[model samples]
Target: MTSITIDLSDSQFRKLQDFARVHGIAIEVLLKASLEDWLNLQKGDFVNTADYVLMKNAELYRRLA
Candidate 1:
């Protein structure tokens, strides 16, 4: 694995440390999990196309044409 360096505000660093302590994990593990979640979100893995179809009103569909 490659090492990376990042800068964070004092508040942000404290928050991350606190989260890692509460979860009984190292800060790097928490950071990795957060980065993974963010990357998945960026790739649109959370969107549900079927749910959108179900949520659309029939009247709206009629109006489109």
Candidate 2:
């Protein structure tokens, strides 16, 4: 797998760290899970940012519908 670096504000980093500890997972693993969840939500089959964009870009998700 490839590795990359991102910069987060102190508050954001702390929130992620706290969630990681609460779920008993490493920060990296939690981040990956979060990404998957976000992608799933954005597929429009679920509620998310995609809900709004889906209506405007109906053709983009023709197969999905």
Candidate 3:
């Protein structure tokens, strides 16, 4: 496995730490799962389709809002 380093603000790090502690997981595990989920979302056509639909219907959505 490859290791990486990220720079987070103190507040951001504290939030992550608190969330991990509350969930009973290590910070590393929480970060890994978050990264994996984000990566998976980027890998599919669903995002592209959603973007296309949203843009195509932007005027209708605005009127409905």
Candidate 4:
């Protein structure tokens, strides 16, 4: 596993800490889960966009091929 350091504003850190405490999870776990969710969302968005573009340009792509 690799570790990383990030700089957060005091308010942001406080907010995260508060949220984590309420959720009964550690800050590290909260961050990891949040990061994973965000990455998955981004991946899904990219795939959807790519599919849309490919479908929209299918005819052009076939002609070019």
Q: Choose the strongest candidate by TM-score.
A: 4
Best by lDDT: 4
Residue-level lDDT of model 1, residues 15-48, one tens digit each, is 9999999999999999999899899886664366
Q: Tell me each candidate's TM-score.
A: 0.61, 0.59, 0.67, 0.90
Per-residue accuracy of model 4 over 1-65 as CA lDDT, tens digit each: 99999999999999999999999999999999999999999999999999999999999999999
Worst 10 residues of 3 by lDDT: 38-47
Estimate, for each residue in 1-65, the C-alpha lDDT of model 3 and write its tens digit.
78888899999999999999999999999999999998888876688988999999999999999
Per-candidate Cα lDDT values, in order, are: 0.85, 0.87, 0.94, 0.99
Better of 1 and 3 by lDDT: 3
* Clash count of each predicted structure: 0, 0, 0, 0
TM-score of 3: 0.67
Arrange candidates by lDDT, highest first: which order?
A: 4, 3, 2, 1
Q: Give RMSD (Å) of candidate 2 vs. truth.
A: 7.1
Which residues of candidate 4, in runs, are more than 4 Å off?
Answer: none
| Predicted candidate 2 versus true structure: per-residue lDDT over 1-65, tens digit per residue | 88889999999999999999999999999999988898887675655665777787888779677
- Report the candidate with higher TM-score, 3 versus 4: 4
Candidate 2 off by > 4 Å:
45-65
Where is model 1 more than 4 Å wrong at Cα? Answer: 45-65
Pairs with backbone N, CA or C atoms under 3 Å apart (clashes), candidate 2: none
